[model samples]
Target: MIVELKNEQFYLCRHLLNRQAHLEPISVINQTNPGRVFVDDNTNPTSGMVWLGNNDGFIFFGNPHNEKFNQYIDPFIDQFLVEEAKKVDLDYMEAIGNSKDWNTTLEKVFKKRNHGNWNQRVYTLKNYEYLDKTEPNIELEYKIQKLDNRILTSVDLTNLDTLKENILESWSTIDDFCSKGIGFCIIVDNEIASYCYSNFVAGSVHCIAIETMEKYQGNKLAQKVAHTFVKECFIHKKLPYWDCMEDNDPSVAVAERLGFKSYFRYIGFDFSF
Candidate 1:
């Protein structure tokens, strides 16, 4: 039978994650990020799954032939997962299989209910010097600001609400993000034009999420803000990670131009509620 593992016990699955130990799963296992884990055997797990705390996705790892794990998948998807997602006000669920065997198993189980299949690219920064530092040459009234309690709590700050929501997407709470996260933003006309922040973190590895206001897109503001965020990561001896859908040209371009090398590719699936 499949059994849920306590947060402290989440580390048991580390061996299964192997080379695909991205922040999402690592954060959960480290208990730095909220999430749930289940395994086919409590004492000696051979297969398992992680339900991301943010309800964003699931990670299927280990032996795909674990009968108990295989049997639990359908109900977990159709019943438990669906209910939990709705509680979070989400309309669908997403997942990734860690290995080719697991990938094929996921396809076989979720194919009919699949909403979409995405090819995701993961990047690693071997050298910090490759980050583009060329600021927008145009004259613009803007200032770079580090994210802090004041920035997170300011009620009247323009676009700050959107930033808070984005942070909450992957973080359990604003306070949690403030304490463990690092970020930088570009303010234009007293409004946040572009920002980059840690989305998921495990140990010294940080995965970043960045966004630029539509009106400010062409100003190279994203590059400017991201450059600072990355530099700060290096200053602290942290490893910055970048992951995005393969078809996300803009995101791919940003990482590539910043000198992040493609690390790995994985298949992800979206399932309907």
Candidate 2:
């Protein structure tokens, strides 16, 4: 019998999911602090698990597959976040995927609901090294340069609103990011030129997401901030994971520049109920 989990069981559940995270880190975001956790075996919540992070749902292969999951779980997930989930926010209920069973089940369910597909690609850092010393081939024009490492509860991007709508909107709130995630920003004249932070973190792995203002795109601010973020990841003994669309040249370029290697490719579907 599947049981809904409580805070007391978080440790055991996190342990199970963390082991699986080593293989599919992207699939197991925020498992350590999920909003809800369900497991077939209470003794080992990780053995057969479905974790509902703030917005994403995760499936793990532990116990034998059961048809009851399809029967009862869909409604539980469809109504998981209700109206807020239907909105296309960064932390919105976007996709559900993990092991083989997870992918197949999610595909079938969304198809039955007449939803479309959302394709995605995943990569991992390869022999990773910081870009702090490897400066980009660009002349520095800004007068005030600072690699502010403090996790700001709120970032000052007043001079760079374009980056806010185009990039930061998908990153939830500054307060949440500051408290739960770690980041570095290249502040130029009190404006955020480039920034890098953890979009998803679980266990020892952090998913890195970086954005540079349009005017500062070619100035190497991204490299500097990413270098700091990656260095911190190592300092904390955590691994870093990178994922982006296959056709996004800029992201692919940065990932490669940071020494990230293409490890796995997966699909994501941002469907509505």
What is the C-alpha local distance difference test score of each model? 0.81, 0.56
**Model 1 poorest ten-residue lDDT run:** 131-140
Q: Candidate 2, which ten residues in sequence have the lowest lDDT sum? A: 142-151
Candidate 1: stretches off by over 4 Å = 132-138
Give the Å shift of residue 128 in candidate 2: 6.1
Deviation of model 1 at 248, angstroms: 0.9
TM-score of 2: 0.69
Across 1-273, the per-residue lDDT of candidate 2 in tens digits comes to 456666566455554443442333323334323345566556654444454443444444443245655454556655554544546353433554554456676666556665555656666653345444564544454432322224242365465555333323334454544545666667666677777767666656677767887887877677667767777778777777887777788888777787776667666656555
Residue 205 error, candidate 2, Å = 2.7
Error of 1 at 83 (Å): 1.7
Q: TM-scores of all models?
A: 0.91, 0.69
User: How well is each residue in 1-273 modelled by candidate 1, as lDDT tens digits?
Assistant: 667898768878888875554568878878787888978887789998888876768888888877778877877667666776778798877888767677788877775674678899998785445655553443468788898888788776778888888888788898898889889988877688889999889888889898999998888787778778888888888888998989999888888778888878888888667
What stretches of model 2 exceed 4 Å from their correct place?
A: 1-3, 14-34, 40-64, 78-93, 126-134, 137-181, 234-237
